[model samples]
Target: MYTFVLPESSRLQEVSAEVSLEELQSQPLQEMIDQMFAIARGERGDTEKRVMVGLAAPQVGIQKRIIFVDTGVDIDRKNLGHLEVFINPILLKKSSAVVLGREGCFSVDPCLCGIVPRSEIVVVQALDRNGKSHTREFSGMTARIFQHEIDHLEGIRFPDRVGPDGVLHWVKEDEYPEYRKNWQQWKVLCSWSDWCAMKSGKSSV
Candidate 1:
């Protein structure tokens, strides 16, 4: 399965503790980021899904303070790009413009999930694959995914921060799968986009 992006909490088992960019020896963070993009673009696991625009270490079973993203780019059933990143990220700041957004997790169970609250913008610091540090200032969906994956590295899940409007009862969560099983038959699917859609009950892809 498409490199199963959703990792369980304990998947944080033995992470790369080298917070500084220089400490990681494994393919370098930028190379790792490129690998993540490869996984997203269907180069690594072109099994069922044909594209991947984002990925974390745990998605491929690595535990490091890195994720790859193309903040303003979109990859769906149409145009996909190599426009992505190897983010050695730390969320140093955030905006107070709280917005409710639909979200899903590569680590969360059953795959499908709901909307959550997140900062509208963020600034982060991390290194590229070469161990040369780069920082980015991002807003909207890009900021949201950065924070979401960062949380994963620290053993957190999206449902823990869900919005009140999207709260689920056990009964509702159960019902959702059956309804969507039939509904999903006609919808175009993309991990990066559909995860966004899980929150809104519509795909952003």
Candidate 2:
């Protein structure tokens, strides 16, 4: 079984390879998908309390272009809370309007989060688990989640998308409420590059 790859691990920095149809139909790949779903749902023993909204293959020590996302809403704006798998996903388009929102990653320290600017809407093309091709347009939180996971396939983490003026904030799991109430007052951490260097043992914060 594969384990979650941390930011410090070099595997997280490598671009993931595409999954061929033959490999996709293999038992091991199917089992990995099952494991990913379990981890996303916080069903795994090592999973944290916060269920992951999305995850990529590289995040779990697999260098393949696979991602699972929880599209929290349905077409009618109803809460669906279901997971979908995308293999060899590609971003087809992105809206000109950008929105800044707080984001955290499972591969990184859960307490570390920062504001990330993302397109308000995105068009993505990929194959489903069964090898069916899909080209869907996603918006709002769903779009954000899709973009984040796709970035992972390209070896890009959420912190790498943080703007120059943006700073990552470390909030303790127990003090989330207080942090939310006074987020601006929280201690500012280093930039994404600095964090990467520190994690790689190239430098300190």
Candidate 3:
């Protein structure tokens, strides 16, 4: 069974231990990757169930440096791509440009969301499911997903990255009508922080 150490319940605050090159080559590693996908794909929240794109080993109570990237899968009629596994991943490069984007974590309690400033693009190097090393670049939300999962390896969560004044608001299921209505439109350009700010009369934007 796959177990996710959600926010306060898990008390998971330590950085993950790196998986060695030899460990990545082990046959058992495939089973772990499979489980990660199962856990990520099956998780649902109280709100309008968020789409899970990737997850880290630590999220599943494993300390190893393993990440499951959901590249291919159908969620709400959108095909994300093929499922990809990364072992002992490394961030080879990150563009200096940054953008504030909406982000939410399954581990976070009450799971309202917040906005975070993330690199617009990032290049990563890691061992694939076959234990083969590859380098790739990602942009937009896909890049954000990689960065979010990688942050888990370093014991960082999205909320921890929000600016001091940035706000994260909870959206109860009943609020989904309004949330869903606006999300469909604002997500194209506005960050959650900005949305919250506007709602609270903090900013005119």
Query: What TM-score would every model get versus the actual structure?
Result: 0.63, 0.85, 0.78
What candidate 2 gets wrong by more than 4 Å, as runs, is: 43-49, 73-80, 178-188, 191-193, 203-205
- After superposing candidate 1 on the true structure, give the runs of residues whose Cα lies further than 4 Å from its correct spot: 1-9, 12-16, 25-34, 43-51, 74-83, 163-205
Provide the RMSD of all predictions against the true structure, rounded to 1 decimal: 8.8, 3.7, 6.9
Q: Which candidate has the top score in lDDT?
A: 2
Candidate 1 C-alpha RMSD relative to the actual structure: 8.8
Which residue runs does candidate 3 get wrong by more than 4 Å? 9-11, 44-48, 72-77, 173-205
Model 3 lDDT, full chain set: 0.69
- For each candidate, the alpha-carbon lDDT, in order, equals 0.56, 0.78, 0.69
Model 3 poorest ten-residue lDDT run: 71-80
lDDT of 2: 0.78
Highest TM-score: give the candidate number: 2
Residues 1-205, candidate 2: write the lDDT tens digits: 6678756786787899999999988898888899888776663232223346688989988899999887774422234477889999998999999997767787777678777899999999999888889999999888999999999988888888885577788767776556555666677565667667745757633
> Residue 165's C-alpha lDDT in candidate 1?
37
What's the number of clashes in each of the models? 11, 0, 5
